[model samples]
Target: MAGSTDVAKVYERFISLVREVHWLNRISDLLSWDQQVMMPPKGVSARSEQYAVLSGLAHDRLAGNEMADLLAHLEAHSDELDEDQRVNVREVRRSHDRARKVPRELIQEIVTTEGLSQKHWLEAKQKDDFSIFAPWLEKMVALKRRVADAIGYEKTPYDPLLDEFEPHTTSEEVAGVLEGLKPALVELVRRIESSSIRPRREILERSFPIAKQEEFGAWIVRLMGFDFEAGRIDRSPHPFCSGANGDVRITTRYKEDYIPASLFGLMHETGHGLYDQGLDPKHEGTPRGFTVSLGVHESQSRLWENLVGRSMHFWRFAFPFLQAF
Candidate 1:
């Protein structure tokens, strides 16, 4: 058996390898981000190939026998670790186990298919044609089903996929929550429709230049505590936040005749950027350093965009700026 010092050394080695894998994953994310926001139209095929290669590399690193051994050792001696170290080990182990269950070829295929699907999706959306995207959507669904089966599940195939993002959640649990909320949501909508008060929708239709919108968005996000030095804002066809921690990037679209679209979209993406920027740097490249779940992440965006950004107090405070524009 290894001594305490020897065990610590092994753990540190394992952490180094994990960090390397995470760096590769981050690079892959950056490539996809560039493909979405900056890559030229002719670069789709090359981008898909690049994504597939990177996905395979990351999956191999995560699913290798070396990782399996390290995780087994860590699990056997988990009592020796600090709470945070134990949590990291557990999360890493979960990821490793899931990755090991899925073949590398399958992982690569999913990445390639997703890239192609996204391209077709954008084209279909632009053309307002569902048929053009139907085949890709069908392919993606079949691939996801295979992935779920490979990962294994107790109740439903969707359980594995839901767990992938939310960790320890199930489709049944989600359905239950949605079922409970349905009546309340319906009542709220009905009440709003029956209310005498009506918003002046045309107020937001006034001309707003893209440059001024960008400047205003920057100001709002800065106030919301998004670090411009550590992050950036760009324009994309659809608004999104990408990257993690020290290098977060967010994008929003602009419409010359629709002020609220860009303004609210920036606020939404900024919320996501703030969460990414706020993660502990020491925990970078680890599960603890990442957003907790997609649902939780969406909550942050909705909080900023709806709860705060749409509040009367916020607009009242910014009324001067709104008038200036």
Candidate 2:
């Protein structure tokens, strides 16, 4: 049996390893954000190599024997640790076990392929050609299937793949929920389509300048509690929120002719940014500090984007400024 001091030392060692892996993942996220937002068109090839190397290094650290031994020891004496330590160990073990089954080479290949595929996707979209991106998309799909097989799923390959984002969840469970919602959603759409009421399109189609749109959106999110000191809002081909520690990046696209596109899009990403910024800073590198699940994250975004951003009361205060801009 390990003494209390010995257990504490082991836990510290485990945390140190966890921190290294966390930092590598965060750095990869930063690079990804740069790739989408700022990287020159010529940098994709080199960036792909960088992503592969980083993915390999991070995978090795998490799935290595040292991490495995630490987890084994801590898990054996889980009673000796507090709630937080135990939770961290359990989550790390879950990831470590899954990662160990997947070859490091496969992980690197997936990362490299992802970078190239994204680049090709953007090009294909710009040129309005699907053929240019189809081959890379196929490669990406095959690689993911390989990963799902490596991880070993019970029902479907998608179960393991979906678990990557929403831990402890299964594709069947997701399908069930979606199926349940589909009926009500279909009914709602049918009602809207058949309704006699028609919205005033001129209000939504009004010419809102892009610069003013940006200004108004920023102002609204600031009031919604997105800390600018720790975050940024930029334009990307698709909207997303990438957050780690104090740095959170939010991106959205602007359509000058469509007022709601950027405004509501920014609101949505800002909702996600707020949730990321609200996480406990002390647990920034550990599972305890991480989000509960993607479902929770999406709830935050949808709550703000639809429940609040679309509310008449919210616009009551916001419309005058919007008109001024």
User: For each candidate, what TM-score against the reference?
Assistant: 0.96, 0.97
Please identify model 1 stretches exceeding 4 Å from their true place.
Answer: none
Model 1 agreement with the true structure over 234-278: per-residue lDDT tens digits: 888789998998899999989998978899999999989988888
Question: Compared with the true structure, what per-residue lDDT tens digits does model 2 show for residues 4-70?
Answer: 7788999999999998888888889988999999999899999999999889998998999999999
Top lDDT model: 2
Which segments of candidate 2 are over 4 A away from where they belong?
Answer: none
Show the lowest summed lDDT stretch of 10 residues, model 2: 1-10
